[model samples]
Target chain A: MYLRGYVSSREFFEYNPPQKIQNLAIRDYCSSNKFNYLLSATEYSMKNSYLILDEFLKFRDGSDGLAFYSIFQLPLNFTLRQNIFDKILKKRKQLHFSLENLALKNKNDINLIHNLFFIKQSYQKCLSLTDIKQNLKL
Target chain B: MLNSTVLSKNFLSDGYLKIRPKNQKYLFEIQKIITNKISKTKLSKKNQISFLNNFHKFQNPSNLNDTRLKIYNYINSKSIFSKMYYEIVKEYLDILVGNELVMQNKINLSIQLPNDKSSILPMHSDTWSGDSPFEIVVWIPLVNCFKTKSMFILNPKESKHFYINYKKNSKKHDSKSLFNLYKSKFKWIDIKFGEVLIFNQCLPHGNVENITSETRWSLNCRFKSLFSPYGTKKIGEFFKPINIKPASVIGFNYNDPLAE
Candidate 1:
């Protein structure tokens, strides 16, 4: 239920998925992406994370992720996704993070462990192109 | 004196301005006149808000239009009404539009009741329907307006982008769909009784049904420079020169005595 799901399918985009879908997507994305680490870090960290994630979900190119970007590109075709991807990538590189140290400090946090599992599963699903390609036709 | 340069810049950037009126009494008097005209019995100033809010109870859709016209004509007939209207926003109008201006001969009153579908104004630009882009509308509310009771206008920058790509965006969508397309971009104006709004009528602006439990009463009149080029709403016919300067009067009266 990442933000990509909203723009992933033409039906969801046209009919507008219910708030339930939007909420689920946001929670799922936040839980999976270790968003809590950034949220608990500092206000600036939270804002930076939000900016990066929003840009990635909204403007990432099909070449990097899935082919759904090319199909759903019809409605918002004017946006140059590749250019946005490059800009976001440049910004992402500038952003420094010490995941190993942060993980050790927050090792006892149950929520972090749960979120990492969610991330692993969602990432695997994303890597499987057949599942998404089939779902797009529906 | 207000900074004309800053005010002009703000108007040009935002496409609208909400400023406190020069005289609050004028607005109260105008509201009183409207309330008296519409109410079957006399209503005190204290009951003005309730009377306006529950206006739908006074009349149904069948007689709404006739009642509206009656009130419109009566208000325009009062000599103090137009004068008061001008006084409310004359300072801003002088800076944004011009001192030598043509005002709409009749002021327009809009009444939107809660959950009423009959009075909704969908998203549209006045210029799209032959109104002059040179014209600016002076809008004043009789009651506090918020959320659905208030109107929405697309910001200048976003509106420009929408217009530039209109053909591509509109090819697959109708007006309603187009409204949904740029729904997030529209700014809902929250204004109170003592304030006046002078807006660029050329920008896309409109209101949905009054979902709130109140009737919305607002008056609007268009003003433009007297010498500015006219759209379908022409000079002398649709608009009359309200503030003619002395030099313009001399130029208007001057005639060349030739062979005749």
Candidate 2:
């Protein structure tokens, strides 16, 4: 299958790996899975920027899928991420996350990805309240 | 007093600093907390140094990990311990790193028993194992550590050469043999109880078997600028914001007016 790589210039997952590093990881992932690799389109390093990704979705080429370096590289806004997923499903194109080694081929896969985002959001919420020391005298 | 510009330049080149803390009370408190928890019998201030130095006698050498984990968990559970840890090195970190910083969630405790082969840290850089190159390690000792009781680090100049040519070096030698080859170049840090050592984690550093009579007790934790580039060890998991400036706080919470 032919897969175009998607990488982000914006820092996510608390750290941003270099675009070169991200691209390399995607290339290796495609090679291991025996998929045809296409040059990556990097999202701009600005808040809520998914312009490149939106453009990638509009392409009507024979590419079978879009591979992301990580699922966290997707837009932080749930609606934006859902819209991307919806676009992928509408196009009948597969979505792959290299770091997570996950695939979104159907509604079930989309649900799994949604669950992961929920889990991460829940974790971040719990962490914000964990610093009990803030109330301590010391 | 040495200016920050000189200190930063020296730190850039040397990659490490051994200096005394501005206040000894916090350091004493930290030592007291660990000692009180570990020692079955209460120790007076006079005996605390001896107690820590000869800890192997009181502690079961075979069950070292159990004692280590207990103290590690105990100290980390107390927010004051971490607060004091940061306070001890706050000045240096502010100058070398920045005022706005993120600290490692859990500080690491090292208990090296005399000649214990199991606990030795092999020669390596934290950056090689997914730690951010921007992070710096603040290492503090509980007793006078010298010779084999302390850790060794390669200077940045030599480390640069070593890392650049690591591909050829790895094929020729393993970690042990690589250590032996560069053995003479390694600086065995001889640090005292009241002093704190801050070093660049990108430099190759580790400890050998503690051949000294005294057991070595040291604590190390990492700190980096809040906005610095990170490796695989991401924030909220490996690190948490210790201090944030007002502008940054406003910036983080700021909603762009132009956004729909």
Candidate 3:
């Protein structure tokens, strides 16, 4: 089925249109696997800034490294953005690990927390890009 | 270094600089944009922090499933104001961090209340041990900032000493409250809306009580040199070649280049 009418149906969405949303893919990725926020962007620069933000926010729950990147990405002006980003990337994890293994970087080493149940678990052993996009609310 | 009136030496020595161009009409326009956005945002508790004289910021709710509001909600609308900011910041950053600079990576919104219980920052400098040299801050206030609700910035020369004295003072005073230690040793700067202040993160700074009724809004961003040291978060791209051009290219009014 096309599922076109399902989105607007009151039965389907008890809330309503204009509902507040979150990009859940990042949270799920971080929670269930050891995916790196740093590597994905270097490999792919999204024409859509929303996708990048949706993925990055999973770190905001609390991670020193993630906060730094958040500060760096601020668009006060381009140069400041670049400079902050420069500092953030100088510290990417060298190992290619799943999103689950990534950690926060404050004065103390923190265990990153992600309690999202992303779509990949029930359907397949690993996450699908399609499922990731849907969860990110993209 | 390039523009004579770009920043006064007094500002540099004081560890703070404010920039005001011949044409400052952009202030009123940006004020309208920010004000409208502020009205639409969720207001925080009336008494968020005791030490804060006053404060306000648009909260990007963590629970929001769609973050488009977070993205477009910034001051970077494609209007003339954004273009002007893009020009001014780009040039000044080149001067401060050298020619090799990146356009933008991140920005911040803050209304700091120094001694308020809601406040969380300990006395610390923007600069930590392994930071990149080019990293600096550009803070433009949406409202006039004065001694009352303003934040504190210790001179860079005195910051390191201040930090040491703070640590020592914290131990001697029987409390970790740095605010109590150097209450009188600090210098403060008062700013009006039509000004932009740039400071090196190495300088120690913090804001306490925002007792005023007016909500203090500041747009802040950090810039870095091409090869600056970034800690491990991994910002995607950096330093696109190098281009230093006329301010007008970014859409700033200027004295004629040919006239000089």
Using lDDT, give the best candidate's number.
2
> How do the residues B124-238 of candidate 1 rate in per-residue lDDT, one tens digit apiece?
9998988878899999999999999999999899999989989898898999999999999999999998888889998999999889988899999999877665667644335
Whichever of 1 and 3 has more TM-score, that candidate is: 1
The better-scoring model by lDDT among 2 and 3 is 2
In model 3, the runs with Cα more than 4 Å from the true position are: A1-25, A28-138, B1-12, B22-25, B38-83, B112-122, B129-133, B163-176, B232-234, B237-260
lDDT of 2 by residue, B94-193 (tens): 8999998888878999999998999999999999999978799999998999999999999999998888889999998998899998899999999999
Q: List, residue by residue over A9-125, the lDDT tens digit for candidate 3.
A: 111111222211111333343443443333223112332233443344334423323411112123323344334344544544111112222233331322111101111111123
Ten-residue region with minimum lDDT total, candidate 3 chain A: A1-10
Q: CA lDDT of each candidate?
A: 0.66, 0.84, 0.44
* Candidate 3 residue B235 C-alpha distance from true site, Å: 3.3
Per-residue lDDT of model 1, residues A1-138, tens digit only: 112222222231223334444335434444544442122111112211334334443434322221121122212221343343345354432111121111211224322323222222222333233444576763
Quick one: best TM-score, which candidate?
Answer: 2
TM-scores for all candidates: the values are 0.64, 0.67, 0.49
- Using DockQ as the measure, which candidate wins? 2
Task: Order candidates by DockQ, high to low.
Answer: 2, 3, 1
Candidate 2 or 3, higher DockQ? 2
DockQ of each: 0.01, 0.03, 0.02
Q: How well is each residue in A11-120 modelled by candidate 2, as lDDT tens digits?
A: 87465789898899899889978999999988988887888888888766668989999878777776888998888898889988877656889988776565455444
